[model samples]
Target chain A: MPFTMTAAALKIDHLGKRFGATAAVDDLSLEIAPGEIFGLLGPNGAGKSTTINMITGVTRPQTGSVSVFGYDNRRQALIARRLVGVMHQEIVIDHFFTVRQAIRIHVGYYGLPDDPGWRATLIERLGLGPHLAKPLRELSGGMKRRFMIAKAMIHKPRLLILDEPTAGVDIELRRSLWEFVREINGQGTTVLLTTHYLEEAEKMCGRIAIMNRGRLVALEGKETLLNRLGGRRLIVTLAQPLATLPAALAEDRSLLSWDPDHLTFAVAGPGAVGERLRRLALGGLHIADLDMRKPDLEEVFLQLTGNGNHHPAAEP
Target chain B: MTGPLPLPPFQPWLPFLTLLKREVLRFLRVSFQTLLAPVITASLYLFVFGATLGQRISVLEGFSYAQFVIPGLILMGIINNSFANTSTSLFMSRYLGNIVDLLVAPITAPQLILAYTLAAMLRGMLVGAVITLIALGFAPLPWVYPGLGLVMALLSSFLFAQFGLIAAIHANTFDALSMFTNFLLLPLIYFGGVFYPVSILPPFWEGLSRCNPLFYLIDGFRFALLGSGDNPFWLSFGISAAMAGGLFLWAALLIATGYRLRN
Candidate 1:
């Protein structure tokens, strides 16, 4: 059982779905490890939701299969669903039900008796205790999102899929939500998240799969993705305004650009930044201050999924 | 870190019970619309049809117009409320995007159909009972065979609830949902011996009335209530029972196929 849990919290093999002439998801395959926070990043119409839908059995796959905790989604849907919990992108809860009542209904869905202690802990953690008696319609967007998270966690599912969990949340609330997610992950729930907020994925996910046009463009650790850009930027603040570029600096025009007050250079390696600084100094260019900018996941995302000739995982 | 928590033994019926409770509560929460309003509507029909028309007409040989219309109105209440309960709930769930609550659960399609259908039946029966009480105020409703009356009522509720479920699945908008209730259901109810006996109709019209399933349900209900109907009690009972079973299977099939409920 332990081995089964570790092998794949979720496994999608050659999954495909089509609506009319359009393919919503095409030959999508992924495996999420137990106890890992996996980020599924994509732009609009990128099939992240489609894949999530198939995993939760909300939508059937036209081809292939999804297995959750060793239960095939189609053949053993009930068991597969038992192992997974999903917080949908929409705030789709019953408006007539109060927060507590809604959560109770969700708890009952998993066949669990209401545990007041656990319910209280979750409510307090989500900062929803004050509004437990408020109807869902009365709650704010962020509060509703918190309620959704709380509902998803009620079942103690082995796999929790959060689709755009922080979409409409404020910055402070997003922080709190992230902390809450980490807390749950710490308690052994494997989180599969999708978000438009790249920074959220960078900070929270151990691994991420970037999809575009119903295909995965990149799947790797956050650090590995960032490192693929292969270099960093050097921003140099000049001591005095430069009317014109020095001949020595002008020689390497491909790597450097300068305005009246600052010079920017794309350095190839860690040692190259220092080498360029020495070169600029030797050329009698004065530097007031210098800062190195590390490449981030956002850059890699734009490059791989952006309008470019480089197609990291383009379909044949 | 400690290992993952072990989940308790999942009792499958718990979800069915929860969904059933939620569906029932959905209507009860708005009792004014789901229960009281229907009773009020049925009362107005009783007033307009029985009070106004009773003095001028007598459709049955032994019964007064009020007695004849009472069973028909009660059965009409059952059919309307049952269909309304399931159709509106399912459609609203889809419209508001809340259907995912059921879709994501570890419940089967059969359980889903049963829960929604049972809840619809309850709402229908509640309204029917209220309307029957109102009808009783006007005239005594004899239960010639209480068992058959109860069975007929249950079967009629079941069949129409399944109809509502099908309509909800097929309807993409509120307009489409109302179209079924208005265009199809209202027409059938009106022509199904709700207002008059099928035996009195022209030969061509009588045969056409037989095609309407509501005719059998209303006739079966009338036979149970007054021991008088245009068709044999056995025929009416058999038709309603067969329809109930067939509609139930169709509902189960649509749910299992994921129909419009899923992608």
Candidate 2:
């Protein structure tokens, strides 16, 4: 593991940004270790992109600071920029150049000497060899995404920020992209990813941060986050219709949903699950069948934001 | 996609040089629209304005109207194309959202401005050269002070390219860019005394014409090219140079502050 006690690859402290009267990001703080694959998760307007922009020096923070590898973004902007690479969510390519030209140009922008063998290797590794001659505007979405990843990696920065990299990609391809990211992570590059796909975050990010309404709602190791904040779910298929609940159990009806032949509710944790079952049994109900669900990242996200819109992830 | 030529050793100037190369290549890629269009347009102007009007007006005592007007036409070519080069390049980059290339790069504000301005100068000078060549076909023109004429051409083009940069930074859409071009840029060119000398205007119009910056550019270029009047070429040079310097500073300030750019 490349994780260490050295300065963080990225550190954002008390960062804030406001547009007009609305706070896009509010006093957010985070420290991503040198070799960790960290995920920043949020609903559409949860300020995830604004945080990324601040980190990349595209948007200046009004309150605090962002540093890449100990170099402050604003004070040592050129040096910080040279040490980090970002692939924004928007797919913007210069139509004037081809993929080959576009990728090679990054070398000059960062003032790095070009290595043809490495360039060819990146092109081949990203499956961009065949499309190198095509104009950038002519490529399909998948190829463009791949090309953008290549562009981001051209300078070989120590840290890479990918904002929604697998967005709009098919399931199989999305998995492969994550596999490539894993390969890069294994090679000792720290990765910061923002993703709408909960399963993707669950599988890839060792740690995750969830944001809501311009605030950090949760930030923890994946398992820890799930255990602490992702409450368990239970569904009961009744032997008889849920009718005439006991007075004590009826008082908890706000958290319980009961239809003619089904009953559902959330269990706060392991202890709460048994207690809830005891209450249901005390109500003189026979349990025909029961289903218990393990909470995924989506459950945690929905619980935090109280919004289910993040799941579709395919939102255009 | 023609494979980029082999890379050289690393240097701090590489990014600036790379941007310059890309910008020069961008205009060259569309040679017909950027380079050839101005030449054909200048030729027609010379024939109609120079030939037909030469028989009627004599601004300078010893020269035909063709000789007197050629310098103005050449300077106009330089100004229009120089402005077009920077304005279209920056506006299109912003419009298409590819400006992220510069925003995220290690290039600084001064480097960005220099690269854009230098590319615009190349384009403006290229158009001026072709127009001057065509003017030679109209008559045998004297190259009185070719060096000074070149200096004036460069200074005027540099000034207008800064305007283009400013307009591009502030323009939100192509329509807004066109408004700058149509409303501000073209009017300055038309009233800048391209066909006839500003001396022919009434006292009030001539005073207004003198207030116009383009008038000094044409006046200086004409004085250097044909020695058409007693106006000192150095005076025109000083004014154009000062204005160019001022606009360059303004552009650098805008980039440094991230006005309408980083946001």
Candidate 3:
């Protein structure tokens, strides 16, 4: 995809934060195009939360600025905040509030008029109607998370930031949350997501930014990032087991591993599969089955993050 | 693929009102701890003092001991409950990490201060009204200048609410919060002439009591109801108005600076 410097939904310019002598986010700059699911991936303590804090105005940045929908977050915080909604990493609902009351109060804060229809739709969609009258303390963990989403969506903000939204939830709930997020994004809301689940990010995010030690390590389209790693593994099943590797395959033995009738070769690129298969054919190897696997976000993430150095088997 | 979102009409008052409603409901939902408990404690104070000391001493002219103590008790409830309403609510929100709702909202620092102070004042007023009604059983409940009485009650509540927000912002632990109430607030209440008039104290102690803002609040409130107090009505009123305005501005500045509440 061609990169253009059009208007952005969210923009961060040379943002930096520090606690005493240690820098949390150092000179970070990025712009998220409107209506895209942008993924922010980082290891623990890599300044993802600090950047979110600066964007949300929970913590003022020592350097640079954040603008949401053309409004400088610090100078025009009220206007900037109105355009943004955030589902916090923790379930931070007030224990004394009923589900309905909590959503109403949140809506009121954005100066949005009370809309019963929209409220009902949100409750029904999040499956929180039955818990409307129950205090937050009475709800289950997943229910509280759903209620948090309901609160965040009360004003139908143009930008939604989800920080680890599905962490610790069951698979079913996680999928449901993803669907709800996608549904809202489909309605023209820009989404910024941070998650530990690379599979989720790979499946959902259009573009991904990886951070390490308060710096941007990689940022690109998901496919571009994955392809840039140039990692592919080919597994071939031979018709007969071989005690010794054939001469043609022996030269490629470093890339090839054998287990019974199956041989796995670590190919450098997707195009190498054709060349390797042609080589095997010439070597008089009877191939019963063949499978080619392109690198996924996990492999790329591990590589860019240098996790591959310490733990080579970081990705399954 | 997406068009611009229609911006909502900026009804600024709605956010303030909603925040006030949330703060009020927070305490009303836990009436046992926020309301009934304070009223019960006030009643116990009234019973212990009015029953034992009422029969022996008459502190002021043309008034029984119970009548003289009633206004002080009502004001005490106002100060304590008002401060507790804001301090406890804000501290609890911070402790539980739920204050992000308010911090991230489209409300300014002054607006936030107003919402918290007003809600706290409302709780304080409600508690004060209940205690006054309960005190009627002990005394006739004088009402000389009803308008002035209302003004005094509001100013006192507003002042204490601001103080409470300041305390909540500075306090990091439960023990720290209690220190504000026990060491600072309770001493001010006791020394402010809740049980005895400052006029009866020695010259040095009376001058020292004048320094306590709560003394002015109680003295003014008593003068409004009974037409008599240690200081002139204007002095008390001036002191309260100054404290309320000054403390409110200070708290608003602190809030705007994101002191303690935000990183």
Q: Against the true structure, whose TM-score is highest?
A: 1
In the range B134-178, model 3's lDDT, one tens digit per residue, is 888877857998799889999989999999999999999999999
Candidate 2 regions with alpha-carbon error over 4 angstroms: A1-5, A230-291, A308-316, B1-10, B55-57
Candidate 2, residues A210-312, lDDT tens digits: the string is 9998999899999998775335557888898865666656666323456767766666634776776777788877789989776688867887887642222
**How would you order the candidates by DockQ, starting with the best?**
1, 3, 2
Looking at model 2 chain A, report the run of 10 residues with the lowest lDDT sum: A307-316
DockQ list for all candidates: 0.50, 0.38, 0.48
How does model 1 score on DockQ? 0.50
- Tens digit of lDDT per residue, candidate 1, span A190-247? 8999999988899999999999888888989888987776666678998988898877
Q: In model 1, state the lDDT of residue A241.
A: 89
Among the numbered candidates, top DockQ falls to 1
Instruction: Tell me how far the alpha carbon of residue A292 in candidate 2 is from the true structure, in angstroms, after superposition.
Output: 4.0
The better candidate by DockQ, 1 or 3, is 1
True contacts kept of each: 0.57, 0.56, 0.62
Question: TM-score, each model?
Answer: 0.92, 0.90, 0.90
- Tell me the spans in candidate 3 whose CA falls farther than 4 Å from its real position: A1-6, A235-265, A269-290, A310-316, B1-6
lDDT of all the models against the reference?
A: 0.86, 0.83, 0.86
Ranking by TM-score: 1, 3, 2
Residue pair clashes in candidate 1: none
